[model samples]
Target: MKAKVYVTLKPSVLDPQGKAIKHSVELLGFSGISDIRQGKYFEIAIEGPLNVDQAREEAVRMAHDVLSNPIIEDFRVEIEE
Candidate 1:
């Protein structure tokens, strides 16, 4: 089984990288681009003794404890179907 974690900054937090990308797009003559945001994606392969449900649970825990910063980021976990 495998799991994916999508990590993103909370809306209230400032995203400098996203801002820079937006600025670059405008400088390149792109118009009407309103907003941009940057985020991270992680794919984890699960091996060993755990079953599918257990692996999914562990994946969610990893997202909360290790994959994302609780203070300024939010994360969503999805198990492979």
Candidate 2:
């Protein structure tokens, strides 16, 4: 089983890296770009005999406990078979 976790900054947070990318894009002639945010992606592979549901539950816990900061970041988890 595999878990894909997407971690991104909260909407209220500022993203300097994303801003730099946006500026670079504008300098390259890209127009009408409003905002950009940077994020993190994690793919965690689980071994053992746990079933899909069990693995999903564990993955959710992992996402909450280890993968994201509740104050500044948001995260989503997807289980891949």
Candidate 3:
């Protein structure tokens, strides 16, 4: 089984890296861009025989406790078998 975790900053947090990338894109002639946000992606491979729901629960716990900062970030988890 595999778990995909996407960790991103909360809407209220400022994303300097994303802003810089947006600026660079504008400088490169891209237009009509309003905002950008940066995030982290994690792929975890589970070794045991776990069901989709169990894998999701484990992934969600890991995402909340280890992958993301609860105060400034939010995370979504996907399970693949």
lDDT of each candidate versus the true structure: 0.92, 0.90, 0.95
Tens digits of per-residue lDDT for model 2, 7-80:
99999999999999999999999999998789999999999998888988988888888899888989988889
Per-residue lDDT of candidate 3, residues 1-81 (tens digit): 899999999999999999999999999999999988999999999987788999999999999999999999999998888
Alpha carbon lDDT of residue 71, candidate 2?
A: 88
Candidate 1 per-residue lDDT over residues 44-72, each given as its tens digit: 99878888788889988999999999999
Instruction: State TM-scores per candidate.
Output: 0.84, 0.87, 0.95
Instruction: Please rank every candidate by lDDT, starting with the best.
Output: 3, 1, 2
Candidate that would win on TM-score: 3
Backbone clash count, each prediction separately = 0, 0, 0
Which 10 successive residues of model 1 have the least lDDT summed? 46-55
Runs in model 3 deviating more than 4 A are none
Judging by lDDT against the true structure, name the best candidate: 3
